[model samples]
Target: MSLLLLVDDPARPDVVGLRSLSDDGTLLDSSEVPTDALPAVARERADRPRWVWDDTARRYPPLLAAGVRVERCHDLRLCHAILRRSVYTQSSALAQAPPGPWDGPRDPAPVEGSLFDDVGPAAVADPLEELQLQLAAVAGSDEPGRLRLLLAAESTGALIAAEMHHGGMPWSVETHDALLTDLLGPRRKGGRPAKLEALADEVRTALGQPALNLDSQPDLLRGLRSAGCDVESTRTWEIKALEHPVRDPLLAYKKLSRLLSANGWAWMEAWVHDGRFRPEYVPGGVVTGRWATSGGGALQLPASIRGAVRADPGWKLVVADAAQLEPRVLAAMSGDGAMAAAGRQADLYQGVVDAGIVETRSEAKYAMLGAIYGATTGPSAVLMPRLTTAYPRAVALVEAAARAGERGDVVSTWLGRTSPRPDAAWQAELAAASAEGAGADDVRAARRRGRDWGRFTRNFVVQGTAAEWALCWMAALRRRLLAVDGRPHLVFFLHDEVMVHSPAAVAESVAVAVHESAVEAGRLLFGETPVDFALDVVVADSYDQAK
Candidate 1:
């Protein structure tokens, strides 16, 4: 008979086809082994039997063949190691090994460091901590039910601030201080000519009382001006001044002749209370490394809100915007002659059409945009072929990059911000499929999946480059705002807009700063690549009024 060697774990409940050694050390199948002796093999107490191949028998040998392999000896440590590596490598099948002898102890944790070691605790109050405190205070109040409503209001205000800041205003302590001073108004050196005194003659003439003194009505006029209602207007001011108060609640109508006109004071008081003069911010709001607002519509500030964003006494707000950012970034990345040429000219989409890439400019625009953005469905997919034919270099570059991504490699932004790679399971699946039969549909599908991964990889480069441009723009604008000695502080930011609270005096200068910053940001990002970033800016007393 041929000698057969078998290595099996009796302790394993799934052990089948296993045999035992007889009393004289002769191997026998489970059927031939005595039933009472089964416990010895099953309990793994008896010495495990091993079969050796007998070459002279001229029959099937059972020792490990040329390629066939199995563990020759029981090694709990080695088995656990194999299992761990299999798990780490994300192998399709688990290691054919037994469990560890016992559960392992916990790993040691890393030590924590103080914030001062990194950013220095001497820095300004932590924005996150401040926000947490504010939130806690609001949440812990007697009216806890109002927390959501309060948060919503706060978020709206933050959005407004972000939009305003995005306009290209600088956010700094000095600018904020200056803006606060302007909003509060400057103190007069000498006793200023009271508004009542200035309008004393007009009041007397309109009221038909030549000798009437109106020294007590200056607050009313100041309040009217603060509400944005012109105190000198004839329709509201003069007409109202002429009407005498028929009854005075405090005087019980006994001094109707002495009572002054309420005029627009009531409306002004209400306006001041309702209008947003200042908004709050929550700096670290976005999970994807972006800022978020706690108050104000930072993401969607209305033009009317700009009217409420007045600058400080002598400072002004500046704003800027980046132009055709992503397309230019794509042109640089792909090095597509047609795309480069399109970018060189004013309109990139038109250039693609002019190059005969597409029948119409709209199609060219959509296709080009979709290509850079990794769009693969519907209309975007339909236009891909034309794009590929027209700019093979660009197509190939992104396609190759995407392939790399599918292979579980990390993709980098233009500035070297690398995306996290796919996990081990993904790598194992791709690797395993790559080794499978050629021409098989499964293999083809795996290759296609890899290509799809590459597309994502390619788009990341362009998108990341665009994001860098935005950051550069923000940084440049921040620097420019700092250069202006006393301008409106940047109180908000959106993707491409900035908002500043500044005085009317420096509004024009702030706008200029914003424009210059955009040009500078472009130069810094692309290094004089005939591309330009232009902005449209408007300045007013309030956020709503800015255009």
Candidate 2:
């Protein structure tokens, strides 16, 4: 049984409508409650029904704030996005139907104040109609079970996101402050850090322009040019190659400047609260089904400040990351036995080296990444033939997707997240390239454009599937940890790495759960495929130790 919840207004609800439905779509109960009493109602039932909501982002936060936790939910907005675009379920009427409010931006402007401060009207009715459509689409898809799994995993991710936000990532404000001070010098009120200011002085002195403002790109570029340095951009790599006294200082200034702007004292004040950094994570935010952070730069946490991520007094942080996840996913998806055999090793790249396919591990990595990312030249391109010969099936899978993309065709992941087709402008360019009077340069430009989009699609299939595997991994680990004693909870999650805050006594249990969950995730994604998704797991006091 699942309880369908309908929201009339996101900011506040005058009444909360709940409809209980059986698996066969029969409505068992229908009732309404005031916004304040809804949590109590939800918690009254021991075997809580799976809450079906239009958007989890809006509803779950308030519930979590009220000390209520939902075990399962069917997020309609997420499922609708998947069903409408997925090629596997396109035959269903829901997929074929024209866009409506359901297809709009899944998240509205975030609620600003108290969760239930703004009282609004009751919802008109249950959103069973939308839920029914999603259910039908999944049941009628080409791979019903797999499509169902994708939806389930995606919704679980939403629940996890909310829960993780409620139990914010453990952060040490003191440590972070100390690190900032050490790296950037003492904080100044309404002024740049001491170290950054000093570097700026070095930059200006090197360029022989005391009045130069390093913050302004145009001014910096002009200063560089006037200093007898031939440079077109202020990019770090471009700056590094130049033979100028300004080069080193300018580079140092840029690095520290970025650090100051992105995660400086102001960032800490705005984001970190109660010794926790609660980044707003948006699941399925990326087109490849990857998670994205709407705030706090969660996805882009730099290694420089990671030492600040410390555990509590009696707890340990179980940090774990999938080893060679994407390549292993490629091997399993392509069913390349030889590639899977290589994945069995602790270091897949070194295994490739041991196989005599590449002289060094670096070459093995370049060739594999080159194959997936579409390297047309350089060392990657030079090593491509050998890698392709070594793992023919894996290389062929990406090539097939690339060719499909070149023809403006869409490709689907293992669980059916499809690549979007080329837009109108691209189509026009491709047509012009093939036209009878196409110039040599025009042909070359069009070829380059095709290959660029081709690279995106080539990487999409593997990357998207790898993301699905990650979601499943997290889901399994979440469930396993929930059943164990000691309140082990996931505190942080990047793409392939997750941190679990656990009692020191149960840290061993958390580590074991993480290892077992990796196996379970692989099994769930590619059953019996001769692939091992190895993990580098460590029970550490801080995150850096695991790395």
Candidate 3:
């Protein structure tokens, strides 16, 4: 049934079942003999387990001699499988076991009403208290104006609630009043402005009016403008909803509404640290040096979330975005004079057409993009031959890099970020296939793969460079904000969007700083590239209505 080998060294002959070798190099069950007889037996066997006499054990004239060692083949796969099975069995048993006292605390009783069911009265009241505490702390700080601005930001939250209520959505009256007070209150060293009562009166003026909320009606916009607020559009972009068939669009809408509600809760929680909502700023989060969201989903905020950003008593947010950033980046990298010149004028794609690179602006745009990205198929494929003929140097560089990568070499970004190389297994597979009568077609496919890899490597250089530009922009903006003596602090940042809280007096200055920072960022990144990174700005009383 089983086999066991035995061996003993002649130097110590007092061990049991000691033998040098076994017949056929396989040791089966053998006779148990006296300790002194072990060495003699082991010397006759072909393969045996080794044994040494244990002098430390005094009793071992020995019933069974010790110091025997078993040796077997070492295979990780077999070992892993054995361990995995044991773990699975244990986990399954644990899962079936009765719940312990420490499993979790009991859930609270569910509330009445659909909107208020999950959220309790305490939940509705806590945010207002939190805002009060935040304002109190900020007011007591050296920068009193900073606290006022934070309070102003809190008002935007009120606007969101008001908008919801105006749409006939359910909300508690206490919560609504709390939000309104936070919004209309004076945000300065002094208490609420004498005109604040008037402002509050104006806000309440729309309370019973149908379609006066920020979303359904543009009344809030008019009100803010009437109140001397300056508002403009920042950036306009379309969001294409994902296509998924649903039984009821209304149900889907409700689900989305609930999701936004949950997102709001999370956003407020993460943002309200230190009595103010200050989210983290991740510089160079994207490959293009644009900012990334670390928390509160600032960049990925839904349309509803935008309604909550508002200008402080005297401050406005100056928002801007680069127009056609990627194409400009491509032009700069390729050093195509015509493309660069066209970008400098108005449209880089049109510039290509003017240079006779293509018949139309659209074709030039696609073909040039395809070339940079190493797209040699589809519509891009049709233009490849023409692109190569027109811009051989530019095309060759990316193509050659792609070829190198397909050949199993690592590629690096402009800033020295290297792509990982193929592992030994991959190399071995390729080598084996090449040896097995792999024809020209096989070789050509390999080269094509390499070329694509090179294209990725080449683009990484450009994209990474762009990312650096964005970091410089943010850092410059932060520095400018800090340089100003007033207390309007930078609070939130999405890729290209920055929110600042400031007193009404210095809001325009803060806007100026934001604008100057953009210019400085451009200079820092491209030096004197003869191109501008223009930003569109918007200032509003509420985040959603800013545009």
Candidate 4:
């Protein structure tokens, strides 16, 4: 594909600059065009050039709003971040270069109008230079092929995020309001809901403190202690362990309180607009490579209000989530054919039971999670050895990652997303543990911190690889959907699940495409790997009814 580098002039809001780059990233030509004519310029191009822009959120939304979608693009900021920290590209000029304008977050608010009108703070990073550096970094990397694949998938993910924002999550105001009313009892202008107030009263009476402030943790804890209850904190789980009489009402209060605060009437009023929830998704937001949303709580939408995610008339929501994604990725990464076989015929846990690795599915789950998460106590720890003994290849991979992390070394995911070095505080703890004057307490603390970080890296490798798989899945699924009729498009994406809004007539075909795309994604990541990325596909009018 040809390359078009977009250059926005902050000083002149009416026109924007564009440059064409050669295959080797050499600038071939430059031109300026009217800002409002961008859509026509893009639409008239027979080449359908891959857009090279400083930030996707800033540049892509307006084109999408104008009804023009590009097939591919290189996102400078996202790729720069990857190459800057990536171990594979450390020797390249890009990684060795000092921190510059591209080192921080891109402007938070995306440009929804003329791109130049919202051009932020006089573009400090030159797109042409940045693209040259990124290309050089990838070409010189240890695993050029893997890094290229990763960069492409990462860029595609950015486009998807922008597209999803433009095409917002389907939301129903009536259903949302009704759910709030049914659960919390009526909206209030400046007061708590009736049910919540009733619960608070019950809590106060049970605690024997009429003036208790349940909202304040210290106040609630002091009130509990004052009422002759032995409580350390106001955490619901800790409260659940208490045998005191106030336990029931207090737990109920906390549960209802969370519902009221997170997805309450106020939240709905702010997030839901024009029958859609348009969250600003921050792609590659988490270090482990999972996505995070900057707004609308897209990742943390609680079950209580999912009913509001209803399909529009003549359309259906196609929801599909992978089953045991991390473990499946782990098996493929480790080349553990036995572990893969265990999940071949049934749910992975049930397959583990049938294979006699563990007596029950619960034990299988705990043991598998423990192995991946570095669990050192409780049932997970106790069951881990048996699992390790049965699945040596898989367990060894994570165990090796843990040991590497304990030594403060960086570990990479299957596709080479390297972890950061241990922080200064962690280094200090290690030094203190080994210094001549170190005491038993110092050594014990260091040991604990080492294990904690070890657990993090152990999970990071599998989890990060799983995230890569998911991005690949969405990229593949998006391509498949683009070919289908009725404009099936992805509207919501959690870590391992995707929700597509499609015309009701093509919902079944969309589901099939979803399954095919999962297979394609698995192939793209681990070619011909036997591990299954099985999905639970559903077609529903409302998200809450999918399960």
Locate the minimum summed-lDDT window of 10 residues in model 1: 53-62
TM-score order of candidates, best first?
A: 4, 2, 3, 1
**527 Cα displacement, candidate 4 (Å):** 0.9
| Model 1 whole-model lDDT (C-alpha atoms) | 0.45
How good is model 1 by TM-score?
A: 0.44
C-alpha RMSD values across all candidates? 28.7, 4.0, 27.0, 3.5
The sequence of per-residue lDDT tens digits that candidate 1 reaches over residues 82-128 is: 12222122221222222222112111111122001112122222222
How does each model score on lDDT?
0.45, 0.86, 0.44, 0.88
Better model by TM-score: candidate 2 vs candidate 3: 2
Q: Give the Å shift of residue 353 in candidate 2.
A: 0.7
lDDT (Cα, 0-100) at 306 in candidate 3: 54
What is candidate 2's CA lDDT for residue 227?
A: 90
8-84, model 2: which lDDT tens digit per residue?
A: 55444678777778765567787878988888877887766788898899889988888888888888878888888
TM-score of each: 0.44, 0.95, 0.46, 0.96
lDDT, candidate 4, equals 0.88
What TM-score number comes out for model 2?
Answer: 0.95
Instruction: List ranges where model 2 is wrong by over 4 Å.
Output: 1-3, 7-12, 109-126
Candidate 2 colliding pairs: 14-120
**What's the C-alpha lDDT at position 504 in model 4?**
99
TM-score of 3: 0.46
